[model samples]
Target: MTVKPADLLWPASTARLAIRPAVVEDLPRIFEYYRKPEVSEWLASHPADLDAFIERARQPELLACIYVVERGDIHIGDLYMGIRDAWAQKEVQAQAHATQAEIGYVIAPDYAGQGYANEAVAELLRICFEDLGLRRVTAECLAENVASWRVMEKAGMRRETVTRQASLHRSGRWLDGYGYAVLADEWRGSLVS
Candidate 1:
């Protein structure tokens, strides 16, 4: 039920970017990005230390596929996506039935607003719906994070719902969350229409 890197293609690239697996050697760069207050503000938690970051990067592949988003050789951000129901993998494979996956992304503060997140997400969605053969891909972000939701919209996802106080922020206050999703057929339709 666990999805492994070997189960999918590696080093998929866009014209201006290269998406690759997150490796142990990437720990320091990962830590640097997550440690920044601006970068970690919307995330669930900031790494306590480099060791914690290293541990996080080492999570089981079945839980999520963590990818490094790079421009040439520079580490700019990350793309995190994981299947929602492990037991449904076989049904999905055999039936071409609907299955769900979740995606999340972050970019360096300096690189904000350059359309990179949108560009990266579009490719990730192709891999999700095409390469991974998923039925739907979803993303949730705090309602206040305009850039986050905007990226989802720019990547062809629609805002499905907003849940009140869906998450407890690092500041101790609950925040509303916006859910966005796009179906595989919808995504494919966008390509031609």
Candidate 2:
């Protein structure tokens, strides 16, 4: 199971959305969601301003992937995933990729409730399992965000766990969180189903 970063494709798209690598031009649109109090409240940190976002959006050397989600040329959202060591037993880790990645996404509030997140996440699962050949992909969100967890489920990821007071919200308080994930085999089986 060897995979070099060059083997993956960029700017992948679906019927209604385009999933592409982040570009400098995406700052303004990406900032649109990052700056909103409603949007930033759930995230770990909020961008102080445009310059902060610019600094944060810079692609790093070893990224699983960071994709901007667009609709008809509009930068409506972004998706991100990064590989991390698994916490399972030695035998389980040896049998799996030894590493799994977590995924997350953000959509502009104006575009919320339109099923765009669901489509983008489903496509992301394809890229993670099929293109990147990753063994597993996971995601988590503040438990209060029903929509976010629902998107993960709609994308075929099963709820793996939940932790109370595991996350610190922008509101300066601990919040419950939900973890969801899908294995490569499970995703493939879902496609057939």
Candidate 3:
């Protein structure tokens, strides 16, 4: 789906963390972040190779969008946004239902506890809704990981369901988890000043 101006909520604010397309120059940093225990544990990773990582990022089937989180030349973390279902975003209806583009995030352990997750996700959600014409953006996380859930809920996603033993998890066994999401309209409704 192509992004149009109407799909954007607003320009990114002064969080001072600019998120731009992941370029070849970002491979080394992204590889380092992905290799970290806190991040690698959840991801399906392979041997660390910058060339391979860059190649994978260029794959079209992935619909991957990675941004290096930077503040004053300090590379803080990486933010990834991908479209799980592009067709659904293009068919957005007024029902406030989600049928496409499941969003997820990961932050370095050292960078945790800061507001990076919130700021990064807010920007991603804005693009998904405002630019892509997406009806909703959804996310899921291990129920035991309260911080991940907090990020989703804080972004205005609802508690949709709790699936038990849905799949393998970092816990080394199947774990119950929650799914949350925010529709474009619901997100707009949430921003009452």
Q: What RMSD does each model have against the real structure?
A: 3.3, 2.5, 4.3
lDDT leaderboard ranking: 1, 2, 3
lDDT of 1 by residue, 1-193 (tens): 2334448777889988888878778778877888899988988888878876777677766224688899988999998887765344664664443367789998988777788898899999988877777778899999999999989998899999999997999899999999999988999999998
Off by over 4 Å in 3: 1-13, 46-52, 60-64, 84-99
Which parts of model 1 have CA positions greater than 4 angstroms off?
1-5, 62-64, 86-98
The CA lDDT at 188 in model 2 is 94
Candidate 2 lDDT, tens digit per residue, 72-174? Answer: 9788898887766677677787655535778899998989889999999999888878777888899988899888999999999999999999887766788
lDDT (0 to 1) per candidate: 0.82, 0.81, 0.70
How displaced is residue 37 in candidate 2, in Å?
A: 2.0
Worst 10 residues of 3 by lDDT: 5-14
66-118 per-residue lDDT for model 3 (tens digits): 65676657677766665654343435642333334687777777777888888
- Residue 29 of model 2, lDDT score: 75
